[model samples]
Target chain A: SQELEQSPQSLIVQEGKNLTINCTSSKTLYGLYWYKQKYGEGLIFLMMLQKGGEEKSHEKITAKLDEKKQQSSLHITASQPSHAGIYLCGADPYGQNFVFGPGTRLSVLP
Target chain B: DTAVSQTPKYLVTQMGNDKSIKCEQNLGHDTMYWYKQDSKKFLKIMFSYNNKELIINETVPNRFSPKSPDKAHLNLHINSLELGDSAVYFCASSLGPSNQPQHFGDGTRLSIL
Candidate 1:
């Protein structure tokens, strides 16, 4: 069975600080997606990475797929209170169904 | 209007009871899916339908049934629910099965007593 692991199961960052979260997969990723989930709400799509070494940024959040396509990282620069939420990485190993990782809870202190 | 919507934001029922959650999407997408989020925040896909036809069915138990009457609606029904059935169920839709971004609905939190 394939597995996806995320580092720093939880994080706390002061407002205006920077933070990074990593997601590693046991198999090569066909597609990698980043999503944010607010408390009591559905997940919001952040970005998608398909090719190796591909990177995307929306606002202050940036996501990068490693050259091996088995690991990805999400970086937040100048984090704010509004950026606090649960970050999840979903990977498709076979190009069909997605396998999601246990999310990393992020807290941005005001 | 919401792109994706689910009813019964919270559901609490006995272990032997049966329950249903309704989902709808207005994005005119061809694929819809049902996902379960466990207590540890691990999300897994249970079922998916494309154009009102069953496409992807995961290793879900037989007690759970998914009905897709149309391209825009997918409903989940669980029979004789057990304690393990308690979790957050999310409904999502995508333009197609592969390489498409999914839009999720606010999950229905199910609790079995």
Candidate 2:
């Protein structure tokens, strides 16, 4: 079985500041997904990384998968209140099912 | 139009009661999945169906059953729910069974009293 561990279970950052959340997997990941979920709402897919050393960016957010494929990081630049939510990392290690981390709660104070 | 949608945004019932959640996706996907998010915000896969066929069934109890009438719809029915069943259930779909990014629904919050 594969498990994912996310660092900084919860974070509080000032608006316009940059922050990074890390996700580490117990096994090499075949695919890594980043999603954002507002309180009481469904998750919004942010980005997906498949190949090792792959990096993708959308607006102010960027995600990178390490060359080892065992760790990934999501970095947000000039964050806003809208970025405050639960950021979750999910990985498919066996190609059969997806395993998710405990999630990182981001609170961006204005 | 919403890519993925779920009915009854919230459900509250007594223990031992049975309930169902319906999910529909309009993205023309071939795979659908059901996930439960516990209070700790840990999301776990409960069931997955690809093209109306069961593909993955995690260690979920038999009391929870997932039905996919077609590739676009997946419904979950829980029997004799217990207090531990209180959580947010989300429905998601992808283009295939493996290595594809998934689109998710708003999720149904279930509360068992």
TM-scores of chain B, in order = 0.99, 0.99
User: Where's the lowest-lDDT run of ten residues in candidate 1 chain B?
Assistant: B94-103
DockQ of each candidate relative to the true complex: 0.86, 0.90
Which candidate number would show the highest lDDT if scored against the true structure? 2
True contacts kept of each: 0.92, 0.92
TM-score, each model? 0.97, 0.98
lDDT, candidate 1, A62-85, per-residue tens:
999999999999999999999998
Docking class of 1: high
lDDT of each: 0.94, 0.95
> Which parts of model 2 are misplaced by more than 4 Å?
none
Q: For candidate 2, write residues A1-110 as lDDT tens digits.
A: 88999988999999999999999999999999999999999999999999999999999999999999999999999999999999999987785578889999999999
The candidate that wins on DockQ is 2
